[model samples]
Target chain A: MNTMEAMLASLPDQYRWAADLTSPSLRAATGALVCGMGGSGIAGDVAGDVAAGAPVFVRKGYGIPGWAERLRPLVVAVSYSGNTEETLSGVEAADRAGLAIAAVSSGGALSRLARDHGWPLVEVPGGLQPRAAFGYLTGAVMRILESAGLVGETGLVEAATVTDELLGADLDGPGRRLADDLAEGLAGRITLIVASGSAAAAAYRWKTQINENAKSPAFTTTIPETDHNEIVGWSTLGSAIRRTVGVVALRDTHEPPRVAARFEPTLGRLSEGASLVGEVWAQGEHPLARIASLCVIGDMVSLRLARNAAVDPVPVEAIEVLKRELGET
Target chain B: MNTMEAMLASLPDQYRWAADLTSPSLRAATGALVCGMGGSGIAGDVAGDVAAGAPVFVRKGYGIPGWAERLRPLVVAVSYSGNTEETLSGVEAADRAGLAIAAVSSGGALSRLARDHGWPLVEVPGGLQPRAAFGYLTGAVMRILESAGLVGETGLVEAATVTDELLGADLDGPGRRLADDLAEGLAGRITLIVASGSAAAAAYRWKTQINENAKSPAFTTTIPETDHNEIVGWSTLGSAIRRTVGVVALRDTHEPPRVAARFEPTLGRLSEGASLVGEVWAQGEHPLARIASLCVIGDMVSLRLARNAAVDPVPVEAIEVLKRELGET
Candidate 1:
C-alpha cells in the first residue's frame, strides 16, 4: 500500500494506543473550546459530534471566541506538531482569560508550554503528516475529554469498537466502493459536498482532504442553509460549468427529521445541472464511528484522485513555501 | 440601474432608518446569540465583528448551538421575512433555555410569535429581497445590541457616520473601482476569496452574494489558517485548472499583525497559478463601516457579473421550489 493507504490502514492501531493516553491534571469542566487548525484542528470538529454532556466548540483561528471567556470552557489546545503558531496564540489567549487549558501534541512548543504552565498535556506519536495522524490526534482528544468526565467511557469504548469493525471490514468493502464511485464521478470536477447536522463536519473534512490530497478545489454547504441561498445558484448554472461540478451528499442517521426531509429535493435540484450526484451514508451506530466511517471513505477517495492525477499526496510544497516565507515576514 | 444596484445604492438610507429603531424590552446580557439563515443570518456575522463588550455568536442552523443554554446569552432572532423556519426553531430553543430573546423582521410568523410571547421585536420595512435589505437587518441587529447594553451607543453612532461617509463618496469611486476589477478578473472564472479576522464575515458575504446574485460558485478561506493546508493545493494546480480560478484577498486593517504578515506570501503563492490575483481593502475606521464597505463592493460586483452573464439578480427559483416541496413533504 502507498503511504496514505498505509496510514489509513494503521488507524485502528493508532487509536488503540492513543486512546489509553491521558493527562494527569485533566478534569471535568463546564464546556470545551477546542483550539487548533487544519488537520490537527479537524479532530475537534469530529469530537464535537460525539462529546456528551458538555458542549464543544472548535476554534480554528489565532485566539478563542470572545464568548469563550465568559463561558469559561476548558480550552483544549491541539497541534499535532506542537508548534503551530495559531494554536500557540490561542493557548496564550486562554491563559489571559484564566480559563482552564489542556494541550495535545507530540513534542513541540505546545508541549513545552504545557510543561512550563503546568497544564495537562497528552502527547501523541509524531513523524506523520498532520492529516495522516488524524486517528492518533482524535484518539488523544477523546481520551482527554473522557478523562475530564465530559465524554463517558462506555460511549468512547463502543465507538472505538465500531470504528475498528468498520475499518477492518473486507478490503473491497464500503470504503473502497465509495472511493471508487467518487474517483469516477469527481474526476476533473470541483466537488460540492452537501451535508448537515453532525455530518457537516465530515463534509468539511471531505472538502479539505480533497483540496490537500487531490489538489483540487472542493466546497461544502450545510443543508437547510444551503436550501436558502446556494440552491438558487444552481438554477442558473450553464451546462459547461455544471459539467465541471460534482455533488456529494453526506448523510447521517442522527440528523433531525426536519433536516433529513430537505435532502432529497435539494439533491434533485442540484443534480439537474451537475456532472454527477451521489450519496454516502454513515456507517455504525455511534456518532464518532459514523463520522469516522464517512471521513475514511473521503480520505481514500482523495488519495485515489491524487494517484489518478499523478500527484504526490505526501509533500505539501506550497504549505512549506508559505511557512518559510512567513518565518521571514 | 438594476434592481440589485438600486438596493446597493439605497443602503445609506436603509441604515439611517434602521439605526434609529430600538426595542425597550431588550437588556444587557453576558453574550449575544444571533440566529437566522441566509440573508437575515448574515447580519449576525457582521454584528459579531463590530459588537463591543459582549461577544456575538451567529447561528445559521435549525436551533441554537449546544453551548448557548449555559452562556445564557440574549438570543437575537433575525429573519427578514419573519417566517424563516430555522430562525423560528432557534427562537423556540432560546425560549426553552430561558434565555433572553429578541426578534428582528419585517412581518411574518416570527413577528407573530414575538408578539404572542411578548418578546421584544424590532420591525424593519419589508418588500425588498432579504439580501437587498442587509443594511436594515444589520442596523436593526446593531440597534438591538446597543439597546441591550451589549454594544455602546457611541461606537454604533460612529459606525453609522463612517458608513455614510464611505458609501457617499464619489459615484464612480472605490466601490465601483473594485467592482470593475472583480468584473474583469472574476468573469467566467470561479472566484476564491481569502480573508481573515473581522473581514472573514465579509468574505463569506461575498461568497454567498456571488453564489446567489452572480449565479457562480465562490469559495472563501480565512488567513493564517489557509496558510496551513489550502496553500498546498495551489502548488500542483495544472495550468488549465488554474486559468479557471480567480483569487481575491479581502483585507481589513484590524486583523492581528501576525495574520497580516502572512497575506503577502500566501497571495504570491496563490497568484502563481490563479487566473488573476487582486486585493480589496476594507474602508472606514470602524469595524462595521469597514465590513460594510467590503460587502457593498462585493454586492455591486455580483450584480455586475449577473448583468454580464445575462442572468437575473432577483428571484431565487430553486429556493422557492425547495420550500414548496418541503411544505408538501
Candidate 2:
C-alpha cells in the first residue's frame, strides 16, 4: 500500500492518540483561528464546518483578521513539519498582538516557541507529508479546542470503521468502481468539482489531489455561488469547454436539499456533451465519516488517474523546487 | 463603446446614486452577513475587506452558518434582479431564525417581502445584468451597514473621481496602454491570476470577466497560500502550463509588507517561461480607488480580450436556462 492508503487505514489510531494528548489549560476566547498552510490548514476548514458554538476560521496568511483582535480568538499555529514560514510568522504576530495562541506540530521552531513561551502545544508524530497526516492534525485540533471547552467527542468515533470497510472492499466495490470509471472519463481533461457545505471540503481535496497526483488541471467551485458566475462560463465557452471538461458533484446526506436541487439543473445544463458528469454520495451515517468517505473516494480516483498517466502518486518534487527558490527570496 | 465599457464608465454614477439614496433604519446587530450570489455577492466580499470593527461575511448557501445564532449577525439579502432563489430562501430562513434582516434589490419578491415585513430595502436600478451592477450593489451594502452602525464612513469617497478619470482617458493613456499590453500578451491563452489582500478581489473580478467576456479558461490563487499546493502544479505541469498560461499579479500599496514578501518568492519560483508575467499597481491613494483601480484595469483587459475573440461581452443565456430549470424543480 502507498503512504496515503496506510495513513487512511491508521486514522482510528491517530484519533485515539490525539484525544489522549495532554497540553496546558487553554484560556477562554470568543472565537478560534487556525493558522496553517496547504493540507495542514484544511483540517481547520473541516473543524469550522461543525464548530457551531464559536467562530472557527482558518487564516492562511501572516496575521489574524482585523476583527480577530476584539474577539480575542484562540489562535492555533499548525505546521506539519513545523517549518511553514506563514504559520510561523502568524504565531509571532499573534503573540505580539497579545492574542491567546497555541501550537500543533511534529517538531520545529514552533515547538521550541511553545516551550519557551509557555504556550499549550500538541506534538504530533513526525516524518509525514502534511497532506497525508490530515487525520492526526484534525484530531489534535479538536482535542486542543476541547481543552478550551470549544468542542465535543461524540460525533466521529465511527468514521474509521466505515472508512476501513470502504477501503477494504476493493474487488468490484462501489468506490473502486467509481474510481475506475472516473479514471477513464477524466483522463487528460480539465476537471470541475461542484459541492456544498461539509462536502465543499471534499471538493477542494479532490481538486488539489487531481492537480498534484495526476498533473492535470482541475478547479473547484462552491454552490450556489458558482451557479451565479461559473454557469455563465459554461454558456459562453460552449463546445471548447464541453470537449475537455469532466464535472463531478460531491453530495452529502447532511447537506440542504437546495444543494441537490441546484445540482440536477446545473448538471443538466452544463454536463451534456461534456467529457464526463458524475456524483458520489456520502457513505456512512456520521458527519465526519461521510465527509471522509467522499474524500477517500476522491483520493482513490486521483490515484487511478496517476496510475494511468504512469506517474508516481507520492512525490512532490515540485514543492521542493519551490522551497529552494523561495529560500533565496 | 461596448456594453462592458459603458458599464465600467458608469460605475462612478452607480456608486453616487447607491450612496445618496435613503432606506429604512436597520436593526442593530453584532456582525453582518451579506446574503447574495454571483456578482452581487462579490459586493459583500469588498465590504468584508474594509469592515474594521465588526466581522462581515458573504454567505452563498441556502441558510446562514450554524454559529449565526450565537453571533446574531445582520443578514442583508442582495439580488440585483430581486429574484435569486438562494437569496430568497436564505432571507426566509434568516427571518425564521429571528436574525436582523434587510434587503437590496430593484423589484421582485424580495422587495415585496421587505415591504410586507417592514425590513429595510435598498432598491437597486433595474435593466442591467447583476455582474455589471457591482459598484451600485457594493455602495448600497456599505450604506446598509452604515445605517446599522456597523461601518464607519471614513474611506472610499474618492473611488468615483479616480475611476471616472481612468474611464475617460483615451488611446495611449496609462490605463489604455496597460490594457493594450495585456491584450497582446494574453490573447488565446489561459490566464492564471495571483493576487493578495484587497487586490485579491480584483483578481477574482478579472478571472470571472475573462471567463465570460473572452470565453476562456482562467483560475486565481491567493498569495502565500498558493506557495503550498499550486506551486506543485507549477512544478509538475511546467512546460505545458507555461506554453498556455498568462500570469498576472494584482498589487496594492495597502497590502501588508508580508503580502509582498510572499509575492517576490512565489513569482521568483513560478513565472519562468510563462506566456505572460506582469503586474498592475493600484492607482490613487485611498483604499477604494486602489481596489477599484485594479479591477477597472482588469475590466479593460477582459473587454480587449472579447474584442479580439469577436464575442459580445454581455448576456449569459445559460444562467437564464438554469433559473428556468430551478423554477420548475
Candidate 3:
C-alpha cells in the first residue's frame, strides 16, 4: 500500500515525460482516431479538447464501421493491457483498411501487433492497473496529437510545468489549508462540476469519481453548452437545491472572455440555493501538463471523498463482478 | 389532437413508400456512414443493425474523424429539417474529403446542398416533427444503405412487412391485448430492457422512451454483453431486486439459437427475486419493416408506461432546460 502511494505520487512526473515524447508523433499525422473502451476512452476526450488542426474521433466497439475502412485515418488504439477486444478489433480494422496506426499499451496483444506491424508504439510503464495509469495514457495521447501536427507543442510543455508546481504546492499543505476548507463546504452535499472548453473532460472525470468513489450522485455539464440548456433546470429545484454543492473549474485560458465572465454570475445565481466552491487552475505551458494536473487533482479529491465516505478508494466490487461475469479474466 | 393521431396512424404506409424508393440507391456504395442528431440518429442505429454485408457507422457530431475520411466511405447525412448544423457540418466534412454522399431530409439546407452538389437525395415528406417522422427516417436510412450495396435488399422488404403487421394487429387494433399486459407488469417497478442483436437497438429505444416519457430512471443492457457484466451486479440488492422488472425482447430469426436458449435461463436466474416479462417479436420479411415494427412497439410501450405513471409523455421540462442552457435551440 505504501509503494502504491509512492507510485501514485510519482505519476505526475512520469506523465510529463510520456506527453513530451509523444508530442512529436502527433504533429505529423493527417488525421487521428483514438480507439479504446470504457475509462481508457477518457484520454480521447482530453485529446479532443487540445488537438490542434487534425480532427479526432473516439471509437468504442467490437468492429469498425465500414466507412472507417475508406477514410484511412491515422489511428491510436489504446488499451491499458494492450488486449481490449474492442480496441484490438479497431486496430485490426485499421490495419486491414491500410490506415496509419499507432499503439499505446503497457503490454498485450496490441503491443505484439504493433511490433509485428511496425506501427509506432508508445509503451506505458507496467505495474499500475489501467485506471490508475491515467497520467501515462493522457500524456501519451497529447504527445501523439502534438507529433501528428494536430496541436501546438508549446501549450503542452507549459501545462506540464504548471501541473508539477500545483501538485508540489499541495493546497492542503500547512499554510494553504485548502483541503479542509473545501471539505467543510462539501460535507453532506452533492457536488456539481461545471467547466468550459477543454476543462469539460476534467469536470466529467470529477463527477464520475465523486459518484464511484464517494458512492454519491454527482453531475457535470460543460459551459456554453450548459449555459444554454441546464440553467433553466436550476430554476425548478427551488428549496431542495440548497442541498447541492457547485464546483466550477476555472481555466484562465481557452474559454472566451464572454464565457469566462458568465461564470461568476452563474455561480452567484445558483449560490442562492446551493453552496458554491471555486477552484481556478491556470493552464500549464503545455496543454498535456495542464490537462493532466486537473485530472490528478480530481483523482485526489475523489480519493479523499472516498475516505470521507468510509469506502475503499480502489476496487469497485460492482464493476468487478460485471467484468468477471463477462469472462474478462 | 384527433388529426394528429390520424397523421400518426398514416406513418407506417408513408414509411413503406420511402423505403421502397430509396433502397436501390444504397445498394451500390462500398461502405456507409449515417450522420444525424438525436431522433434522426435513432434511424441510423436501426439501419446499421439491419445492414447485411457492409458495416455502417452512425456519426453524431460536428465532423467525421480523420480516419473515417481516409476510408472514402459513402455518407448519408440525415436531418429532418435538412438544416441541422451538426449534420450539415458532417456533410461538408465528407464533401471536402471527397466521399460519395447522400442526403435524407424534408427540404432544408442539406437538401439544397445535396442538389447543388448533385449528390443522391431522398426527400422525406414534410409537415411532421422530426420525432413523429421516425418511420420515414428509418426507411430512408434502410433504402440508402441498400442502394449503397452495403446490405441485402430482401431484409428491407421483410422488415417493412413485419412493421405493417405489428401496427395493424396489436398497437392500432381494438382487440390488441399486449399493451394492457405490459402495463400491468411494468407499473410501479423500475423497468430494465434487455435484448440481443438488432433488437438491442429497439431495447435502447425502449429505455430512452421510458426515461423521457415515464420520467423515471430505467436502464438497458444488451444481452451477451450483460451476460458478461451486469448479471453479477444483481447479487448485492437482495430483496430490493423484487422491485425491479425485466423486459426481454426476443426476435425469431436473427439471434443465434444458443443465445436464444440462454435468454430464459438467464432471466429466470436474474429474476428469481424480481419480475420478468418476455415479448417475442417475429421480424418482418424486410429489414426496414422489422426495425420499424419494433420501434413502434417500443414507443407505444414507453408512452403507456408514462401514462400509467401519470406523467405527460411528450414534454421533458428538464431536457428543455438543458437545451436552453446549452443554447442548442
True contacts kept of each: 0.60, 0.52, 0.06
Worst 10 residues of 2 chain A by lDDT: A165-174
Per-candidate Cα lDDT values, in order, are 0.80, 0.75, 0.62
In TM-score terms, candidate 1 sits at 0.95
In the range B49-97, model 1's lDDT, one tens digit per residue, is: 7873367888888888877866678999999998888888899888888
Query: Evaluated with lDDT, which candidate comes out highest?
Result: 1
Per-residue C-alpha lDDT of model 1 across residues A179-292, encoded as one tens digit per residue: 877878888777889998678779988988987888877888898888877776665656766777799989998888989999898888777666555888887777787888
Docking class of 1: medium
Model 3 chain A: weakest 10-residue lDDT segment is: A170-179
How high is the lDDT of residue B154 in model 2? 25
Q: What is the lDDT of residue A268 in candidate 1?
A: 86
Question: Judged by TM-score, which candidate is best?
Answer: 1
What's the lDDT for residue A65 in model 1?
78
Q: Taking the tens digit of each residue's C-alpha lDDT, what string does model 3 give over A233-317?
A: 3432234445434454546465556457657655654455456776756445455556665665665665555566555655545
lDDT of 3: 0.62
